[model samples]
Target: MPNPLDPSLATLIERHTGPVKQLRPTEHGRGSDLTALAETEAGAVFVKAMRDRGRAGGRRDSLLREIAVAPHLGGLAPALLWGEADSGWVVGGWEAAEGRPVDLRPGSTDLPAVVDVVRRVGELPLPEVAEDWPEQRWDRFVAPGEEDLFAGRALLYTDWHPHNFLLGPAGCWLVDWSWPTRGAAFISPALLVVELVAAGHQPAAAQGLLADCPAWSGAPAAAVDAFAAAHALMCRSAADRRPQQPWLAAVADAAECWAAHRAEG
Candidate 1:
């Protein structure tokens, strides 16, 4: 079904971006009420909308966080153009990063750009954004009394799902800043390596790629192992919230395998 923009939101889109010549809704993803491509007088704009009520609050909060955090991201993310969050709806438009989802299969050409972008992004020092600390949130996954090491000054884009990236002539552009997690600089890339494993890379091969990330190289072995174990537990626990998710199950298993591999070192 073509995503039909709400009439109320269309007015706001035109007001913020000028007259909409046409709108073509993109395939709906895991969250958000609407995702569409609009041909506006201003040009192409990627639009996302949330109602700012009920379940919408989660997506709304996520988008708001993206708005807060995107400026610090340099060119690694799509540009947020305009937004409003009063009344019943929260909507924002972004400069469309025209590209395709990244392919992370072993030996894929996209890996280099992916690593480069990850390095640049991982190097971006965490500014004073009111983001949540990941360590506190992941505490439930840590073994009791184990040394706490998840905290750091690095600003992390915790969601590393394959669909969140776009690869074009400009390289990899990370999109969907739904969960702006703050933690150790190595943690984000570490999380992504688990995703790489899930996408069919051997744990060793995935770990090999992480060496390109400076923070990963600086990470303590024990701390990295602990994080892997903790991530496995977190993935398993989160799967409980979305019972019967096949993808979550696969990621949980992959995370466990990576954790086990790290423990072997």
Candidate 2:
């Protein structure tokens, strides 16, 4: 296939890292129009690009958000090597992270590392740039009169799918900051519980995996219950919109299971 990187974009990247020795187009991720790993004089850098027109244009904002939050993430996420916008495209190059996506199944050894990373993320001080980006993705789904339950000052890596957490010799790194949010700290662990459930663990067992996490342990029962219900609604709506995606429907089922478990408690 022709290199998806525009000629001008390639020239721009070359200016920063020398000639691209090789460029390998990668599978599309949730937020990127074009993604690849490019070998350059500076070494391997993961590149993500999005066009500034049509539906793809909206994702440029996500890339900008990731650029802003990258430095503040400490070592929990891959470092952003460089990012720039030119010729109607937003592009970012990040330190190529080496790891395999974590396993969220019950009894998986990767569980401990997953919990550790989520805890560290919750402990990070909220980034100033995210102050106005309150966690509102679930607003429409939240129960009436309970919107305040999701309020907090913690930085949340709201996307909790197994692929988002990579485990390797170096350690676990949470990738993808496209939708990072400022919200109640417990929201991270709670979202993880949903993924665990989707990965074949029972709802109660999933919650147990993160039982020791400070955010999870300290979360108010009422607040967690509200989030569980709202998240289930959100997943169901997404599944409805994309009926062909079995994964979305599966997640909707998991969220429903978690919400029911919380209601029972």
Candidate 3:
């Protein structure tokens, strides 16, 4: 399909990269979001435009978070070139990253690279504005107490599905920073463990991926267990409320396994 950019947005890009030659829509994100690759004199520039600012499970200010965090991600994420608001939408252009989606199977080589990315992202400078601590966000889902486990100084990318990653040449380049959470440095890795179960990994095997990360090793066991339980409750609640979709049901099952594994551990 042609680039979905309206004349105003198209004019804006054309002015930057000369008359656009090829515009291709990307299928990696939600339907309401427009991600496209535009061929220009410099090469391919990735563009993301949302009808409004929000991600799958974020506050209404999600668009603001993405815009604020994009500039500081350095090599771990695509660099933002420019951004603007156009006709009820927020749009930005980024240095395009090329790679295949990560395969999160039990013994995939990509695991190590993903771990490296997690550590690097953990090291990135915190955005000026921090979102609420992860514990606060997941608090309602947990049984009653156990909120301290989610508090930390690190910037976290809360969404961890395979589609959000691209195992590129330099390393595993993470594409979406839409739902950054302010929390423990190890939280991202912990979230990855749950996703691994959804992707067919046993809990122990998936948790093993975090062994080398200092943050994950430093986290208290009880706190980690609390996070797993909270995530499980959140996933189950989501599945229950929505139309019966296989992926949601499957994720809920994965969350259950991780939470159960944590409980048993």
* Cα TM-score per model: 0.91, 0.95, 0.89
Tens digits of per-residue lDDT for model 3, 149-177: 67778888878878788877766788877
How many clashing residue pairs appear in each of the predictions shown?
0, 0, 0
Clashing pairs in 2: none
Which candidate, 1 or 3, has the higher TM-score? 1
Best-to-worst ranking by lDDT: 2, 1, 3
Span of 10 residues, lowest total lDDT, candidate 3: 52-61
TM-score of 1: 0.91
10 residues in a row with least lDDT, candidate 1:
130-139
lDDT of 2 by residue, 173-249 (tens): 99888978888999988998998899999988988888888989999999999999999999999999999989899
Give Cα-based local distance difference scores for all models. Answer: 0.80, 0.86, 0.77
User: Which candidate leads the pack in lDDT?
Assistant: 2
- lDDT-wise, the better of 2 and 3 is 2
